[model samples]
Target: MVLPTFVLSAALATSVAAYDTLLNFHGAPEVETRTIDDIHKAAVAEGGVVTLWHGGDEKTQQDALKEAFEKRFPGMTLNLTVDISKYIDGDIDRQLSQGNVYVDSVILQTLQDYPRWDQEGALLRYKPLDFDKIHPGFRDVWASWYAVVVFGWTNIWNTEKVSEGPVEYSDFLKPEYKDKLVFTYPNDDDAVLYAFDLAMQQNGYSWFENLLAQNPRWVRGTATPTTVMAQANNSYAVTFTGALGLAPTAPFNVSIPKNGFFVTWGQRAAILKDAPHKEGAKLLHNFLLSEEYQSPNNTGMWSVRKDIPAPAGFPELMDVNSTNPIDFERFMADRERVERLKLFFESKIGSAQGLSPLVDDL
Candidate 1:
């Protein structure tokens, strides 16, 4: 392993000279194409250490990637720094500003950053081996970043508590469910906020207005609602990217509202242009999108590859009623409106810094 290190310290300060030089750095000039084996050979020759900074808890996800990568490449090491995407982004920005680039690659759910990175010429633009097999909705026009998974912001209910599940967003506003639900704060999660954005387009702002009247308890992390619902303290949750394929064996179970739904494009992954271990980073990025890693058995979320089938019980991308298939370009383009929505949500939901008692690891 790459002597696992964390670069989250706030003390890392910027140097204008370092920033100016490294900011324009792009590892080895771009090439037309390279076969997977060619890429593998180059990666092995480059000392095989690829440091990655990502969002969300590392737990099952990154642990699985580490095992799979070592098993496939033998000598390669994948050192991952897992935390909130916002925090990881901050750390990376500081490191970049100081010209102390530690991470070779970054995969984050913060959709806005991918385009920004591309604009700054900070991303390596090599397409993955199976780039063409990706669904159009998930593809980046610039090819600087691509989705590794497809996730949804929807409802999950405690089967032990709710006899019947909500059919749509408005159902959560009912008197009976008031104070009986928990959710990720809309302001804290862009995906969740996008969900509300879609809901407003379909059901109108009244949906959020009425939902606020019900007063659902809010949590900060996207995964917190599922955790809170499982505790039985909250009967239901209407936020967070739903985990697919995993069988529900406990008190909580995930559900997609039939009336409408929204999906978040998964981690937008890219190799940093100035990454010290560029070849290794390229290998890891390709491996992440490989059929094995994207298989339903390996990933709980839906894979972006069209060749892969959804797990038996889970619905395929085409089967779902995606009321508003998020156009990431448009979503990112409307930053001012998104900020306004966040501010509007904060006015009603109070602070977005919610902490669920059970989710201590975050």
Candidate 2:
């Protein structure tokens, strides 16, 4: 593994770094490098084109990823087609219907949502260099999944719209905000569902209920609500999404709320069990895990690569202290339990994505 180390002072928190140590978890390094540069071009030319069916709609995120991958793997061209609509609907059913697996690898919402992909012989696993750099809560002991990036949800607001509005969490539930609020439909994004779950843990079931009562517009992808906040002059919405960082060129802004509510890299990258392009897929997957491909700034919720310092706009995660981040094994093993939550919530309110045609298509 060509992984560098991350060295921290006695006071890990206050210590400053200029790209120093490479952390090792348990025993393995955070990232691993196989030196594919020699054949990266040859492999691509001989193979032709490669397609990456990724999830989500971040601003510069798509372009940033495409540029990095294409530049590294020269011979092959990358098809950066982000199928945001499917969002892990029915992986098995979709694969069965397609006759073959449709995607190479996927950046899913979270591993806890569907752990069967690795076991049902549906997915493969690969580890990155300095894998140990991340907190224990984010790692996968069984090697079922590895957090490619680190990100989470926090309230975001328009600098302009929010100037006179909320300064904290309680303001978000105010009666005045009304329909002016925009948020990703929780039913569509598992992370959002989990975020609501966290809110339930911190506040109560009425937390989301109050937010809903304010008449927030449900967006398709988690980032859409934040986008609207920046462009539409909307006050606030689920802002901690990666979309906030992707919009570096735009006027939009996202602020981490002062409260204890937070979620990270709500999305995870995993190889499909029956991946047709498993080799190339794993190659691409590991490459993304490397520091070479990630942004340099540290802030937005993205995969926490030691080399790729957090984005300038994002905040390092120092708040993830024992809120009992979901158990990957339990989530993966208890398929029925996840279904029960989805079903119960669906019965009560239905998918927020089902509300509008435009929003649904987003």
In model 1, state the lDDT of residue 120.
60
Query: What tens-digit string does per-residue lDDT give for candidate 2 at 143-246?
Result: 45666665555555565554443535556677667766776656666666666555666777677678768766666666567556656544453343334552
- Local accuracy by lDDT, each model: 0.70, 0.54
Lowest lDDT 10-residue stretch of candidate 2: 16-25
- Give candidate 2's TM-score: 0.69
Error of 1 at 71 (Å): 3.5
Q: Give the Cα error of residue 234 in candidate 1, in Å.
A: 5.6
Q: Model 1: residues >4 Å from true position, as ranges? A: 1-42, 57-61, 232-249, 313-315, 323-326, 354-359
Clashes of 2: 37
